[model samples]
Target: MKKDNKLKLNLQAILTDLLIWIYILGCVSFLVNHWFEKIIQTNFVVIFGVAAGFISFILGLSIGRKIFLPTIKTEGKWYKTFWGWSVFLLLLITFIVGWNLVEVDLYKLFAKFQNAGGIMKGIFNPNMDIFMQCLAALAETIYLALLATAFAIPLAFFLSFFAARNLMPQTFLGNTVYIIVRTIATIFRSIEAIVWAIIFSVWVGIGPFAGMLALMIHSIASLTKLYSEQIENINPGPVEAIKATGANTIQTWIFAVVPQIISPFLAFTIYRWDINVRMATIVGFVGGGGIGLLLLQQQQMLRWQNVGIIIWMIAIVVWIMDMVSAKVRGKLQEM
Candidate 1:
């Protein structure tokens, strides 16, 4: 009973602090307008925002109470206290810096919002023919992702064993191989696929080929990480036993690690392919050529209904891919 009271008190204290912070934020903006000749009109928004803040505060308080029913037993509150204080301090510092750091008039923001409103609304009614065109492009995007992932999976498997410190020989020769593999993975992952796609599009000309190249590079990096982790985590006893029987490094790896992690590798590859398909669609916008090219063209042409169809079709494809990938991964894991 006493603990419950303490929780309620803590909640109240937290809410009170938030209210004080809100007022301080308003005042900070208020200062920018009246001081330093920088007229920041925060009044119109400040007034309404502050009012909404209070209303939200009351609603949030009620929700918090509702989450913990009367029958629920409370536990140690140290973690909660630590998290609450940490968050409060972080947010308080953020607000303090934000107020003095920048100032803007509410009216200008409102005007910009009003101006963009119509175009944003028009985005909903997309063009149907352009959308159908996007669907075809999206299929090409999926195909590129599939092909890239297929190429990367086996290649990554070979790279990861060399990369794994435990599996490789403890000589300069082995360490060099590890360094090379790691360096390649890091370089590939560091560059965004869209950037890769941009470069490839220039090299190959605008088409799915550029997108496939981008996906392949990205997949090599991502698959290397997943494969290396799986290789490093595999049971070492079988590897050691195989090595003792006069087996070569390749033979030992084939006998031990490959059998253990093949399922997981397949699972990871399937999941990555699904993710790549979705990313491939977006990369097309940068001239790599996929559904995104169609979507962008439609948007530029003011084909709202087509744009709507493109978005919906993309969503459906992504959803199906997710489901299919999950099921396939689950089966691979079971195997």
Candidate 2:
């Protein structure tokens, strides 16, 4: 029995390693193909990608075994181990690649400093004439964020229970529900609100309504993730006690889970509101309506003073929201 158990564990480890290698191979191959296809100008690009991926897989296996296998002693200096060297190499490679990809050049910044003088001067002397107009737009931005958060709260609250692994029943149906809810939330959350805003702008026309919808959808996904995680971290003591009383799943959640998560949920919701407020400005650049749209217009026309006014207003409003949300979340934590 002991031998058989050891064999089983070995098989499982091997299978897991194979799967990880396969994933790495696929990603490396795709990246190689994408970046070299045009330059290579031949079917050899595909072959090169495959070769690169194979080499990467072999190296990965070697490094993984050296770092993880029990044959390596843990008492030595970290830099003397394979793991430390691997990390150093990884970071060095990443920095080199990132620098090339972003085309970093410090010389141009200093050389072009004088070109921005007009813009800086205008920003320093903001046009107060458009103060009322910018204020109204800022108000609309605030309201848009507020409405999105308000509408998302109940839906997110409803879906989070289904997403929480510990809260779901240990049955096929329960597992299916958990997977489906989690998948939907992840898919939506992966998409930025600005992208959603672009889609909705085309669907519902360019206005605050479209922006509100975009923010609402994103908020629902974000809040569901936060709420589910909070539920998962709750004390098992309350849960077991509720189960001992012959309570059903719903009753268990209501009695054992809800109370513990309420304060954290409120705090998370307030944090989301603060996030939405900031996102609202970004979405507006894509015709989602708000001060960002106004800022975009002034920028395009090179009306730097007016743009400065809008920027200041947005900064002020964001700062105020940040302070208010912080205070509210602090109070909730105390509760």
lDDT at position 15, candidate 2: 48
lDDT of each: 0.76, 0.82
Record all residue pairs in model 2 with backbone atoms less than 3 Å apart, i.e. clashing.
none
TM-score of 1: 0.68
- The numbered model that scores best in TM-score is 2
lDDT of 1 by residue, 147-255 (tens): 8888888788778887787887888998899889888898898999999999999999888888888889888898898899888898899988998999997898889
lDDT of 2 by residue, 13-131 (tens): 44444444444444444446557853433345445544543454345433444433445345566587644564565566556556656878999888989998878978899999999
Clash count per candidate: 10, 0
**Candidate achieving the largest lDDT:** 2
User: Relative to the unseen true structure, what is the C-alpha lDDT of residue 138 in candidate 1, on a scale of 0 to 100?
Assistant: 81
Deviating ranges (above 4 Å) for candidate 2: 1-61, 67-91
Candidate 1: segments with Cα more than 4 A from true spot: 1-126
lDDT of 1: 0.76
C-alpha TM-score for every candidate: 0.68, 0.81
